[model samples]
Target: MSQKRNIFEEVSDEARDEQAVQPGMIDRGRGGARKAIRAWLMVLFGLVVAMIVVGGLTRLTDSGLSITEWRPVTGALPPMSEAEWQSEFDKYKQIDQWRIQNQWMDLADFKEIYWWEWGHRQLGRLIGVVWALGFFGFMAARKIPTGWTGRLFLLGALGGAQGAIGWWMVASGVTQGEGMTSVASYRLATHLGLAFVILGFIAWYAYMLGRDERDLMQARRAKEAKLFSLSTGLMHFAFLQIIIGAFVAGIDAGRSYTDWPLIGGQLLPPDMSVLDPWWRNLFESPGLVQFIHRCAGYLLFAFGVVVWLRGRQSAHPQTRFAFNAVFAALSLQVVLGITTVVYAAPWHIAIAHQLLAVILWALILRARFLSAYPVATSVRG
Candidate 1:
């Protein structure tokens, strides 16, 4: 108090005090980076959903096997000239799918299916480019938040693997000669299953990044363990149902049975063991596969009800609402599934059913997330 402070020393002391008061200022940059990455991921999520819808159309149109070769780099370009188009068509003609099922298809007919498959592949390539550009751009600028680079990279890796799996699925139909017109049911299931897995990761990451890291950590302490576990089971059950549904789609099993609450007018449809091996019937027999899918749907709905009951008991309104949405979507999807069956799985109705699965999947994930990191709400509600 006796000594006079230097002007420079006083300024430095004030600056240090300011820094101490706003320690989080240093982390603001990271937070901003996380927000940007989340926005980018949201874009990827939309593209993926488009890809799924387009893929559904592709399968419905019987266009998945139009392209016989897997050229990740060179195949992006569609046929540029008549000669090129003929060359591609010739290649397609050599495949079993073309020789047996589509021999009557002319160049014009081939072009239609070609465009669907080509467009689907093109969209995939675009997704890869977007991911690469965003990830590398962030890496170059050193903007990616801590503990996130690996997760982003994992998405890219899975995407790359998905491309290979797509080829694998296509090859199943192409390789088999005479009487084989579609890909193996199990292979198709794998391809679709992976797609859902990728979509789930994107959604979960986006949701997590929407909130502050500290807030999420704090919310975790109040996690509803029972509800979380039930939701977890529901998620897995839903995924299994999706895979089973894929098997049904793979062989047009949904079209095989139009009657619900009964299969072919019986608890179990006849000819389930028409295939040589009993296990093969599970995947190859239309009646057996459809039966399993129906049973799984009922079980899934029952389990969803149980989970919703537990979720309703949560003190948090947002968490409760999340589960409510899940139940509502689940119920609607069940109705859609039934309608699709009653209508004999027409392309329009079937595609709508598939898209609803996407919605239900997202809602389930959101509900599970809320269970784990519930949003705090007032007690008055």
Candidate 2:
């Protein structure tokens, strides 16, 4: 039997090792530079949040129209000399905001407001530069993960479009004949809505990159589809509420009704139809706009509760904790919203409310990401 042994009966260890398959190109390079990419995204996220806060301050201080021009390239340097400052001020004087509302502002006053808007625009420029350098640097180094080139480029494109839209919003109020003192309410809402959208994409990408590619693949098999769907709906609802809040800010609606649970001591504000045309009241009427914002807040809170209940049933403790954080932020947001209104949207309270909205949005997104790629736990743990 030993003398007649077949060659297939046994194989050497080296032969077996030689026949083993290896990972393909896609698998081998699946998660390139994940940690570095996430770090870059987080930096962008912080800048966007700062941009939002500065923007809100500009609007509150009636300084958004101070620049009066959108010179994307040359605007980086502020007015350097008295003559340049005067020239810039002259351009601002042509706008209705100057003619109608800021007649009291001298050059010194103008400089103060100018600095606010200037800082906002400067921050925007900084974000663009950071994005460009990071993205191309990654590409040049061949460190970007597969399927991520287009995703990263999209951020820059959207940012460019946002700059154009910012000008569009400013143009609405810079007119000579329309008698406009501020940007159109709908345009403001549009501008703000896009910011939230951009912020959301950054946050989601960061969350995805937080885990290893193999881990994400395995986690996807255990995805809670229903919970993910619910969280998605909740995200949209929250975004809608943010847009409504922008409209409220656009027309100074928060100051119109300092009383909560009642508008001017009534369930509904009186004279909602005071604005021309029936539909105009929805966006143009302070009383009506604030009323709608209040109602939306209530509905958002209710929907959040339902989503939290669903999230609590998740099998993973990490997912459960994510949802709990979301619910906590949502509750704090509601309280801040009320405080903002009762105090008539003071700069401190209003800014705090807006900041909390950003936090809540990020938390909801984190919970949704967990639903899609939940972390696994052992029975003993």
Candidate 3:
């Protein structure tokens, strides 16, 4: 004998089945942690740009060797007292840069350059601290996204190496005796090149994190192979130009030849092989260095135009616009480069040129990322 069921109560097998399975289903909540980490990275990105600009200023002012010592911790605290300032000045005096180049710099003058280098170093320390706190905080809470722990760690590692390289660059000028007023051109290029590398990583990471993981995975299906390859070549070419530009700055080559579209009133300057070894002239010869920089600039612009033309053919409007920006920046940068040469690379113009390079670098990365992950738009767009 079975009990009679109440007719007023609903008996739905589908509803029961749904309720039973709901608890076992995975919960993919909104990406709150991912967004938070991305925001932190953006902050780090800004700081890195600031670091680059400040470094350029420090070099332009010839203040990179003012400290003469690497005191990562103690050096953060600037000399506050008169005696401390004197001690700092004395240390700088022992360096060859002081004896040969800055012999005229008194204590008061020394203080000015000292502050520039000090500030540059202090900013670097600040960046490291920020990265450490953000990274560890995310890690401790287990908020770091899957497959991102190693990438985040790489940033800190590169930053640490940059600091050591900075010291090495400064040491080059200090240790070299007469006729050496600045750091080695090659070492300076290494230091600057690393800075740009770190910048590129932060930029690419930020861009990837801007979209949802699934969306990015889906977009990868529509990747533009040709555009990505072109942009990759453009990136490498731009980087080579940057290193060459560093060599120019290292030897004050910009001021040596103040003519554009011509070097020393000709396509090639007179003393290209003046240095003993032919290779040494490439790095040490102002005319040859500047000439290489100029030639690279022309080639970069031509290649950029080619990339932009291909990028214009992209079906996505946003991708097309991204490449358009790259072209615009490349054009402006070319103008600035020529102007920089015409005016002998004044501090202001030179710094602007360097900063523009940073902008162009980021733009190229953006275009490249878009090519790899084309953003879908409406047909009308």
Best by TM-score: 2
Q: lDDT per residue, candidate 1, 1-381, as tens digits?
A: 667778776457766787776546445655648889999999999999999889989999999989989999999888899999999999899888887789899999999999999999999999999999999999998988877889999999999999999999988888646566878788899999999999999999999998877778779999999899999999999999999999999999999989887889999988689998789999989999999999999999999999999889989998999999999999999999999998999999998999999999999999999989998875665
Model 1 off-target regions past 4 Å?
1-32, 176-178, 378-381
Could you tell me every candidate's TM-score relative to the true structure? 0.93, 0.96, 0.93
State the local distance difference test value for candidate 2.
0.93
Instruction: Give the total clashing residue pairs for model 1.
Output: 0
- Give all candidates' CA lDDT scores: 0.91, 0.93, 0.91
Model 3 per-residue lDDT tens digits across residues 294-374: 999999999999999999999999999999999999999999999999998889999999999999999999999999999
Candidate 3: worst 10 consecutive residues by lDDT? 23-32
lDDT of 1: 0.91
lDDT of 1 at 29: 57
Over 4 Å off, model 2: 1-11, 19-26
Clashing pairs in 1: none
**What CA root-mean-square deviation does each model show from the true structure?**
3.7, 2.4, 3.8
- The 10 consecutive residues of candidate 1 with the worst lDDT sum are 23-32
Model 3 scores a C-alpha lDDT of 0.91
